[model samples]
Target chain A: MDMYTCDSMPSSRSEGSARSKLLSLAGMSKSYSPTVCALNGLDLSIEPGEFITVVGPSGCGKSTLFNIVAGLEEPDAGSEIRFLNKPVNKASELLGQVSFMPQRDLLLPWRTVIDNAILAIELEGKRRADARRIALDMLPEFGLAGFENQYPNQLSGGMRQRVALMRTFLFGRDLMLLDEPFGALDALTRTMMQRWLLDVWQKHRRTIMFITHDVEEALFLGDRVLVMTARPGRIKLELPVTLDRPREPDIVTSPEFIRLKRELLIAIEEESRKSFAPTPSAGH
Target chain B: MNVARDLLKHLCEALLRGALTVLTMAVVWELVVRVGGVPSYYLPSLVDVLAAVTVAPGAYVDSALRTIAETVLGFAGGAVFGVLIGVAFFQWKALRDYLFPMFVISQTIPVIAFGAVVVLWFGNTLWAKAVIAFYMTFFPVTVNTLQGLNAVDPRQVALLRSFGANAWQLLTRLRLPAALPQIFVALKLGATLSLLGAIAGEWFGDSVGVGVLLLHAMYNEQIPALWAAIFLAGAIGTLLYAVMSYIETRFVFWRDEL
Candidate 1:
């Protein structure tokens, strides 16, 4: 089994490397109420043009982390979040800096495909005609060539996700946070989407932080896979995947892929069991 | 050709059903009045009511047009005000908390009871009838608009916020569009209520309108004229409702599927 320490990896700020630091979280903690702590003392750094997949037990603050990074919520005090080496003082400041996709493909049912794709640009005050023109041009690239005028309900689950992905990409942000984007798809469709996503990622070369509960998905897609603890989640393990890319679906059956998947399963299983364990303490 | 044929079939079915119902009712009424030996002044036969309508078609038509004008005017005014207030309430929690219960209370006061006050305030003008109609029409719209606005999916709101959408941008683009189906529901209810309000207002002393004709027929002891006036009012209300329903189907075409 191959393992790499995060510190040993070349920093984005280091000379002679094409990669550059895009995001860094230091001692990041988030609490929803007085009784609920979602994330605690988490620290991580991301370089540009890397795919990082995160996996954890249910209710382990996976979504909370995404929310904080997306600028929908602020981290607790004594925490620091830096984007492109610049510290952000407020959660709202992170707006428009990163694109985010929730687990459900939240496409507006009222809007047609082309209109939905241009939602972000339209929000930025661009003219509707210009946004439509640009979205029309990118439809074929998103596998949505002839479906521009169709509403969200008219499309299949996979096609809806493709439309959402196109919307996220069209936002043109440097960092993207996608939370289980294909988790709702069937097994066959999920595999197909993963390969298609990789192809798109390779072409775009944007920094991506993907959240998932599936171990095989983590191993298959990420350059680095992070496993988090049961609750008040923080990174418990970070394993760099050594699989060479332009990866095909057949790679999941390979011995090296299986080995990595097994290791990640064990790490995630330990945390999952902790979450399901009965709490011994009485109500305070 | 096929689409046209299908539409024609639907139209025929609807007309056939309506004709059957009317014919049954007419026969039942005619038999009951004749067998009971009821006087024509107390309760007119269906034939007598039809004769009344034919006798003074011009008078009935003029009154119908005036009432339609008041209903349409008041409905339009109420819709505009209701949407504006609903949006304001959504933007300010304090305003909604302080004022929403008041709106509910105002609705409880019967439109007929409020019609007296409307006539006292506006006096014999078309505005008097319109004021009552407006009063009846706005509250449902305000309540439904609020419900629809509140019903927007939180995830969709977050998605827009992530894209740096400000409050106005969120409302115009997402919140307003999402609330449309519910707003249309209230609008349909308002359409019927506005017509009722207009007719009730006319009873407070109007020179023209179906309500005025009904009062004239009642005082003069013209049973067939009274029935004819009632029929015209019912017809207009149904027409308004049908038109509103059609508009709703066109605008909110996604409702059934979504």
Candidate 2:
């Protein structure tokens, strides 16, 4: 375990500087229709190379926020989203700036593991042979060494997620948005994947924004955990984990870990209760 | 060596099963004709038809080849155009809304009724038969292509779009490959329909095809010759379908794994 004072912490971003912020969202809001708001006036600042985990109730606009970040959907007017200090006007302008992994592995069934891993590189108009060579080298690191030629269906669920993670890593974007990537996995596999993911993240040090419903997962993986409110979601609480790393699987059972989990549980439980409460006027 | 043996065993089993079916059908047909005291003109025995084919194998082979050429040409043209139009329709919703109904209406017009008009336009050349075949083949291909394209997982599209995939790249890399299994279904249907169209087109006074031979045998009351022509046509249809199935297996290999 390694510990450092806040002032002496080693970060890609300079300590307490605006320039350290890789992404900042001020009054960031989205609505599918005129009357229905999915996200509302959410403000968040993410430091470079930080692992930020967000947990919220179901239908709490978590996906909407990811969509906006991924350039799949636009935020409503007056919402501000900045990437690397530049303001993004349209949702599409954010394209290729971040690597996004949706909940499902979403691997192309036709493509082999290596081919799927190199899809982002190929899309950027790079040479297939070069991309394939790079993907081949990275396969062993991602635990997919021998299964390069196998289709997505041939691999187990955990292996498929690993392939998806490998694909995101190969994209080599500074910012990565993962939407409940290991939510589908069983308890044992999820725990193993968590430790494996931290090991990879420590080595790569790419800024990651992970969304998960599991409170333990959020606390275990994140340097900072953000709890979001119910529908038309807004950040309700931001708790910084001061625990030392490299964190082991056993650290999840520590007293400090339990304390943090209890605090998050309270915040999340309050928001989840609000989610079930009837709105003033709901429309289909 | 073990894999090879298994493959050989599978092939032998398939062939033996097919042979048994043919033998049983032949015996039943011979029994029905002889026992029922059916006239030769009304219904020929399997042996009579085989003898008729052997008598003038050249004529039967030549006619079969010509019809096959027409069917193949028309099917190729239809498949290419259908896929292109399907892609166009998928890219533009307004275009699909306007043209897809017209395609539906076009299919409703009987092949016989449209074959006469096709002959008038294309004349008695090979093009005339090909035109009818194209007409029959294109509809299923277009319908299935659109269905397949529309059926693509939306999440997959979003994932690619996040990677900054342009329209052409998305189509080539994702949409096209995803649509293959469904597209192959239409192609298999189109194969049989194309053969039927080519034979029907020959009814409009074409001189050299299986359709012409069938018309001649029918009018002259040459029952064995008619059955031989029918058999030749059936064989061609079966062959085309088998070829398409082989292609489907090759291209849509992921379907079996799924």
Q: Taking the true A–B contacts (Cα pairs closer than 8 Å), what share appears in each candidate?
A: 0.72, 0.70
Docking class of 1: medium
The fraction of reference A/B contacts recovered in model 2 reads 0.70
The Cα local distance difference test for each model comes to 0.87, 0.88
Indicate which candidate wins on DockQ: 1
lDDT tens digits, residue span B1-258, model 2: 975565556556655887898899889889989998888877899899999989988999899999999999999999998998999999999999999999998889898988778888989999999988998999888888888988989999999999999999989999988998889999999999999999999999788999999999999889999999988998898778867876776679798744
lDDT of 2 by residue, A40-133 (tens): 7788889899999999999888999999999999887777788898888887898887999999999998999999999998999889999999
Q: What local lDDT score does residue A199 receive in model 1, on the 0 to 100 scale?
A: 88
Off by over 4 Å in 2: A1-19, A279-284, B1-16, B256-258
Number of the predicted model whose TM-score against the real structure is largest: 2
lDDT at A159 for candidate 1? Answer: 94
RMSD of each: 5.2, 6.5
